[model samples]
Target: MARISYTTVSPLTHSLNVTKRWTTSLGIWGVGAGAAALLFLSVTPLVRREVLVKVPVLKLYYEDTTPASDKPF
Candidate 1:
């Protein structure tokens, strides 16, 4: 009778491979999130500012009415 033992890949090798994959995935996710956040912040402020500026602000000058104001279309 003979005792037999078998081992596959080493535990250290498996853990290192797993770590490499996890880091790679995290790197990709971080870049994607940073880009999305930048785009959102950059575009939202510009759109809001444009909208704010477009709103009509009427200033009535009681002493400055001219003939152009009298002409009606």
Candidate 2:
């Protein structure tokens, strides 16, 4: 018959390992979230300004060509 030896892990060591894994995953997620937030903040103003600049053009396209006197309001 052959004898097999099994290694046992301590609870504290297991907990520490779990904590380390969670910390690493959270750290990576936090960095990604921060980068996304920064990108959004940086792009938001530019997008808003661009939309603002184009609003008059859009309004012109949609504006009624009929004389104001013909309008009901």
Candidate 3:
């Protein structure tokens, strides 16, 4: 009697494993970058008007209270 051993590895899983072993700080950097992007976008009128203003908790914090005369844009 003979038995065969089959093994399979996903390309994504392999690359992720390599990345995990290569550096532990990679994920921390990625999170920081994402937060930076979110912070930058949060001040934009498009994001404020279309997204942030809809959140009850954040709406007050993001709202623009300056008079039109004082606006630089």
Candidate 4:
């Protein structure tokens, strides 16, 4: 009697085939867009408190430095 064997496609290979070079480029572009959005939102109050304030390096940079006399809003 002879043994029988079967070959199967791997998950990694399947995924690689489903995604093309353009998909990888699009992912890189998406990351860049997200970073740009975060940078633009950095000065907003919500972002400052929730994101910048927690960062050790940016914490000092985002601190309120103005005096009461200069603050009107």
**C-alpha lDDT score of every prediction, in listed order:** 0.64, 0.71, 0.87, 0.89
Q: Residue-wise lDDT of candidate 1 within 1-73, one digit each (tens)?
A: 9999987999999999999989989999999997677557644646435443354542231122557868674
Q: What tens-digit string does per-residue lDDT give for candidate 4 at 4-53?
A: 99889999988888787569989999999988998999889899888888
Which pairs clash in the backbone of model 3? none
lDDT by residue (tens digit), candidate 2, 1-73: 9999999999999999999989989999999997677557644646435543366755464344779899888
Instruction: State the lDDT of candidate 3 residue by residue for 1-73, as single tens digits.
Output: 8999988999999999998886778878998998788688997889888888898998899888999999888
Residue pairs in steric clash, candidate 4? none
Provide the lDDT at 21 for model 2.
84
Pairs clashing in candidate 1? none
Q: What RMSD, rounded to one decimal, does every model reach?
A: 14.5, 12.0, 7.3, 6.9
TM-score against native, each model = 0.41, 0.43, 0.44, 0.54
> On a 0 to 100 scale, what is the lDDT of residue 56 in model 2?
75
Cα RMSD for predicted model 4? 6.9
Task: Score candidate 3 by lDDT.
Answer: 0.87
- Where model 2 places Cα greater than 4 Å from the true spot, the runs are 43-73
How many Å off is the CA of 51 in candidate 3? Answer: 0.3
CA deviation > 4 Å runs, candidate 4: 1-12, 16-27
Task: Please name the candidate that would achieve the greatest TM-score relative to the true structure.
Answer: 4
**Residue 9 error for model 3, in Å?**
19
